[model samples]
Target: MPVTPGGKASDGTRADAGALAGVEECEEAPDVSLEALGSVATTTDASPGTVVPGSPAGTPAGPVSGTSPDREAAGTGSGRDTPVERLEDPGNSATERGTGRPGVAEKTLEQALPSVLADGPPKVLAELARAPQRSRAVRRDGLRRMGIATGLVALLAVVFCAVQVLRPLPGPALVMTGAPSYTIAGAPLTPAWPGEGEAAVEVEGVGSLGAYGDQKPIPTGSMAKVMTAYVVLQDHPLKNGDDGPVIAVDAQTAKESTAPGESTAVVAEGQRFTERQMLQLMLIPSGNNIARLLSRWDAGSDAAFLGRMSGAARQLGMNDTTYTDPSGLDAGTRSTAVDQIRLARAAMQDPTFSAVVAMPRVTIAGVGQIDNNNTDLVDPGVIGIKTGSTSAAGGNLMWAAQQTVGGSKQLILGVVMAQHSAGASDYGLAKALAVSQKLINQVRKALTCTTVVHRGEVVGYLDDGVGGRAPVVAGADLTVIGWPGQSTQLTLSAPVTGLPHRAKAGTTVGTIALRTGQAAGTEVPVVLQHDMTTPGLSQRIARLR
Candidate 1:
């Protein structure tokens, strides 16, 4: 066999060499060895009786014209039958030969020239070339479906957002309407002792203990005089009490201050007493007459003092208090328990007010000092405050007390107004005292004890129950009821407005006035329980020592 290097056929005959005469023999009788020719053409020529091994062993064979390159070329001519050869060669099977069997033909104009001129183009051949472009069309349909799906998803998202935006929120967190602190210990503290009304002790930045009967307007008895004294003291101080400035009792005061079944300092018409003497009579004795005198000295008339009282009430936001006279003798002074608590907190801020209210007794230079009649404050823990009594207004009083809690000082104010009247025995002073005791007990129970630090050391406890029992802090002066459970709203007012930092612990800070509705509320002493001053480096170092 002759072989060509580099996969070429060289000058070899094709498989059809024996089937046809040679080219030179085409013009004459050809002389060729079929066997030699068949060998070169890659075919077999066997006798009728011979057998090929891979074929049926005993089968007689014809001239074998196995698949050859020429046969494939021949099928392209004559527009004749082209055997639909199974595109795969089963015997050689793709995996056995590294060069796999031919796939579906992809016809091009240049390579398919002969077929194009014959029966146009085979339908299968034309379609085979178009398969790739048709695949793109299928992918386009999928993209269209995905686009529609995305649009539906976006629409649903928008609808959900709209529904959420249109919905409403929950309602306000309210437990009860109106004030709830009045029903303390099964008694009312409004318009009288244990009278029904709202009240609270609000230490700024700390929580409030009680919130009851803050809206009612009821008589506050002699407690109204607290406002009168507060206003007078705010505007005027004793002109050197030892010198004893003559305060002539005016006729208008004697007439206006007189109330049926109301106590007076027994101030006679034109009777003169020092301002200091008047204050003792007014606060210690709870004298309606002396209140009138102080009012006349400061505002020139009880009506003027009453007007100032109302104005002050408005400034302090005592919306429920009303005042007709400064003495609280029941020409119609009124307030709620809560308003009185406000007034008490405001009055307790003044140093002088605290001193005056806390003194057990005092003697005037010109006139002999009267007894401090408020025995309720004589209790060791009690701090004496002001008291008021009148038949119409009932017995009313404001007092403050202190106790240790969580290593800190906690102050409490108790107020009583419109208490049940005792039948003419010392003007219900005894009943007022009883009411004060009851109020004190309620306050002590309401206080939640906790500990707090002052100046980096554990000082005391705060009763406000705001958590951590931190240091007790009172920003303004606070007033308390001299009597217990007085029903009236309290409003706080300061003469100079806001307080200063670095106020000494125990320093008077502001006023707590107790009153009922739009009336001048009574004032009480309020003091600082903790130091608010920031220390300098030197001061801090010294403190360490």
Candidate 2:
């Protein structure tokens, strides 16, 4: 019995007996059994002892037709001589398996070597078993990076908030009020006394010289007309050269002008006058009737007009002044020289009043030109103001004069009240005029005007906070007038820690105020003389002192 390569019978019939013969032999040699080599040897219909590809070299050829090698060695097979053939190459064996060819078998050694050395599949299987631990390590690294980034952002946010809270805020710039001051070289000469009542003198830009007697209110007489004109102008404002609105005279005002001992322009009903013309008539001639007429025209009644006059007095800071009548005819109408000086200063600020009061005389349509009753108008440098006279009020004069002192025109305003006549033969007007003239002369001689600060001159220095200094200069020339031998003081106003860096030249940073005596001082603008640049960090730190 013969078997095929697939272990089937060669005659195409059952042959269990021949298959059992090799089984017993394989059992006897267990180490070299067909199962251990993963295949069994078989006989094919080829020539006897022919070797197949992939068979081990130097081993017995495939199954012999007559007797098998194992059976022959064991002396258990029928005797028959079979020739053996050499085995084919291993590369040819792999080619034969891949192609399933019956006889053709050819391949290179390089091709067979790869199949014998391949271990990729096994290595990939080993790595797959340990994948869980590697994945966990990657996840942990990502989380650590994210934590570090979040912590860095939070630290930067805290640092920003701290810097904002600790930084300093800038302060406000400086400011100045009032006027400048001047100094004199010698003691001022005092004026001679010639009046029986209170008298005082005041320079326009300077302070009051002195006052005599009590400051109690005395009869103002016709000086009350000054307030009358002031209130009228306030209600109907008139500029310096304006003719102002027309005011018609009423029949009732004409009747009042005929009152006994009252000064009158004798204005009749239906007469028309401009505001400027009416002011001249009332102020120049000291007309009581014209004053009352203006009062009635302004407030619709003399009483209401007097109320406005009292309010105007308080507004001008004249606390001691009282107005009982527009014309000052009432004995109750009284004021002090100090209060009158304040009133005079305010009234003269109006250009129309300043022009009208200085005139010696003026004419009207209804009445001929009347002379100003102020007798001192003829005196040297004497300007026309008002004059008042009565037995009870004595004589009162509010006068202004312009005199050259240190080559500048000085406007001197003086007032004398309750000046009485020496005897029954003379009038108190003479005493009032004499006293006012003497006082004006004394001020004109004692006071002098001087230029205190020149434009672009360095008035002082500004600290730059790092031990460096910058020049502070006046923006313009400043001049002031004061009595001889008076002391002048300079006050500076600026920022608390000086000016900031990079301040431009010509920028106003502060002010220089000059004070003389007890008067309100004047102020001049202070500016940087040159551009101030910011100091370097090292320079600022080094010059900390």
**CA RMSD, predictions in order:** 18.1, 20.2
Give me the overall lDDT of model 1.
0.52
On the 0 to 100 scale, the lDDT of residue 371 in model 2 is 89
Which lDDT value does model 2 have at 20? 31
- Please state the error at residue 413 of candidate 2 in Å: 1.4
List candidate 1 stretches off by more than 4 Å. Answer: 1-112, 115-215, 237-261, 266-277, 441-545
Model 2, residue 401: C-alpha shift (Å):
1.7
lDDT of 2 by residue, 206-229 (tens): 667778779899998888998998
- Which candidate gets the maximum lDDT versus the true structure? 2
Question: What's the CA error at residue 491 for candidate 2, in Å?
Answer: 2.6
